[model samples]
Target: MAWHKKPKTNLTKLRIVRMIVQIIMFFLLNLVFFEIGANWLVLPINMPQTIFSSSEGSFFLLQRMLSRAIIPLIPLASFLIIGGIFGRLFCAWGCPFGLFQDIIGLITSWVKKYEPTHSTNNSMRQIGELITGGTLLISTFIGISVGLGNQADVEAAFGSFFEQPWAVLSPAVFLFTAIPVIVYWGVLGELFRIENLGSIDILLWIRLAIFIGAIIMIIYIPRGWCRWICPVGIIMGRLGEHSLIGVGRNITKCNHCGICEDVCPMGVQILSHPAERVRSVHCTNCLDCIPACDEDAMELKIL
Candidate 1:
């Protein structure tokens, strides 16, 4: 009798697919943001409890669900739980910031030989987490304070909070849209013929600088922005825990080759230890590991 052996996993194909999807979404978001802001086809909206301040944001889904009070919190709760389980897949496959990093990575590659290195420092990342915590706490306070006696008061208070507090600290606006406009026009545009342009709002500049600085940090490491400075990422990371959806690693049949870790844009240690547990909150669930692994040791599982 002949012994049978399984084939090794190949990741190039999978990474290509993810890269393609991210690219498509990035372009689409750019168009959507432009249409809403420049063409006025879609009206601007706000999230009553925006995790952070961003002019272009809304909690439409959350607001509707919570307002009715009929549908159990299970739905929203399920979403967070499932998302966390699968790693922060949304950030890798869906977030505009992730897409931006991909684009910038391309630019940096062409301009010079930039190695994909890890941003080892965790202090800046901690600060981002603190800011996100503060935002959530304050938003909750505003929600409770305004609705102290009546639903009408709660609605009014939430509305006021979103308009003022949330719009200002939204790192997404600066990271995804504002600073890109600035540097693309200010530095990269002048040097290259790219259609890069940016705007300056004195009031928004300070927060904008923080986001821009995050991107600059990316120069040292891939996904430095998402890893260290994004509040949106912070929100998603928290929600990811207890998520019904997740990936599992088959460690018994495994070799400890580090291919999966190498491909991880978010800098997670995928191949180390028992495969089932990936502790880094930054895992984007991009599945870059599945294809990269030669042993076919990884699979996605739902709890």
Candidate 2:
């Protein structure tokens, strides 16, 4: 009698599960601001809190001779530790902005097929790197001048200088702040007895433009923001370069098919080696490749 091979677990299902959980957590984090300690812990997640401020703090510390507090370091430490072990799984599974991109990808797919070409993907990657570098440079300069030193006056000078550039540039900011404000003021204004929510300003328009542009890009290219312009992603990618945990391929089972590579949103060449740990910094550990391989060749392993 011939033995039948048992069906492999659908890893993509796990990705979906993570997305669902992230969606719930994302909304809760924004809507319900509960404090764990005296510090007002602000959503135990790193992206929403630290991504905007980590670089600024780092640059500030570098510029100042003053002793720094341990409180500020906690977020950066948490992000680095998790990223080093899990290879940016948070970007794929936990980031609210990442989930927003995934939703756009699904919606766009229904209307039209948008598979990114190799050259296009490379160009996008370069653009993302440029944006990340520019942001860091600007933040560092500001931190050095106004965010630290004896001349420091973040409350008075920094706001006038930077003018909330982070909020204007960040999609997460638009989603959590602008969207909520619009909904409350524009949508729920009639329902509730409230006055003077304030009119949308030019900064809000800029945020709207950034938000819309990001959505359009994600629809055309999967994980477009993550691939090209997210400073947080750049930081995480660098930290996760030598991640202890990653996807591995089974050489004996692999049939040399390119399905895994094709399905990869990050454009990682996963099948380049017959069997080896995928150490690509771009690998988000989404495990989409696992379900793509029919022969049960790809597996998530820890070292």
Candidate 3:
């Protein structure tokens, strides 16, 4: 829960630049202030869009389309094309949730979050893959069920979980969509029922618990949700693990000081990765390691 020892690193230029990009993307994707109307500009980011919203990440769109028995051609294409070009770059620079985590990381940087060894970190990433695939499978199953006219059975079994599995409990989704919808619809009046507690949906409390749990995890471990549980991250990682755009280590100028790894919220082992590029799926192309290196050992690589 605590990083007892680590190398000190100054706030780097790349980090600041990334924060700027995160800020810009945050507003652009939300469009809540503008209300541009519904559109299909899907991308590989961790954004949540409601029916009235203008944007959505490919992962959610994929589940939604599949649940309706649609092929989701555009969303599928968005994930591949964007992930190919940027890898998890959207996760780092464009995701609103990523921006939120960056703010938390900045605040907690003084105390420092615990950094797991690369091996342990890598093992934990399997959890994300399972979540990503599991959600997709559920979506596909529901699609098939709906196609077979088993609507009642589907609702009986899934309820809120029908369209989006993990997303029903997704922290970003709850933060961005569920919360707003609740407040706007005056759902608070239903929660207490003042007379009867049985009318309350247990899922509501469970969703809030998950949302809070994710935030709590990030406070003690940087990018904990990204590294361990984001279904969108795993999907992008699979589609873009060998992406052309990524971080590279300049071995010639490198001294293996470990500052880059220490600064990396994802706990990427920069020293062990290939000098030409880091191909780890866990890497979000954050470029945080760049300025952390005093030896000028880190740089961006374009294939």
Candidate topping lDDT: 3
In candidate 3, position 293 carries an lDDT of 75
Instruction: Give the alpha-carbon lDDT of every model.
Output: 0.54, 0.61, 0.81
User: Tens digit of lDDT per residue, candidate 1, span 1-303?
Assistant: 111122223465676677888766554444544443321111111112222222222222333333433342543453455454554666777566577676777567544323433454355578768865665555555445545645566556565344234345555555544555657668545533444223534555567576567556665567776776666566566665455565568888677766566566676666543467565566667777676566777777666
RMSD of each: 8.7, 6.4, 3.2
CA lDDT, candidate 2, residue 129 = 74
User: What value of lDDT does candidate 2 attain over all alpha carbons?
Assistant: 0.61
Pairs in steric clash, model 2:
128-228
Model 2: CA > 4 A from native: 1-12, 31-72, 147-164, 187-200
| lDDT head-to-head 2 vs 3, winner | 3
RMSD in Å for model 3: 3.2
2 or 3, greater by TM-score: 3
In angstroms, the error of model 2 at 242 is: 0.9
- True-vs-predicted CA distance for residue 203, candidate 3, Å: 0.5
Which candidate has the top score in TM-score? 3
How do the residues 17-50 of candidate 2 rate in per-residue lDDT, one tens digit apiece? 7678778756554443442222233211233333
Q: By lDDT, is 1 or 2 better?
A: 2
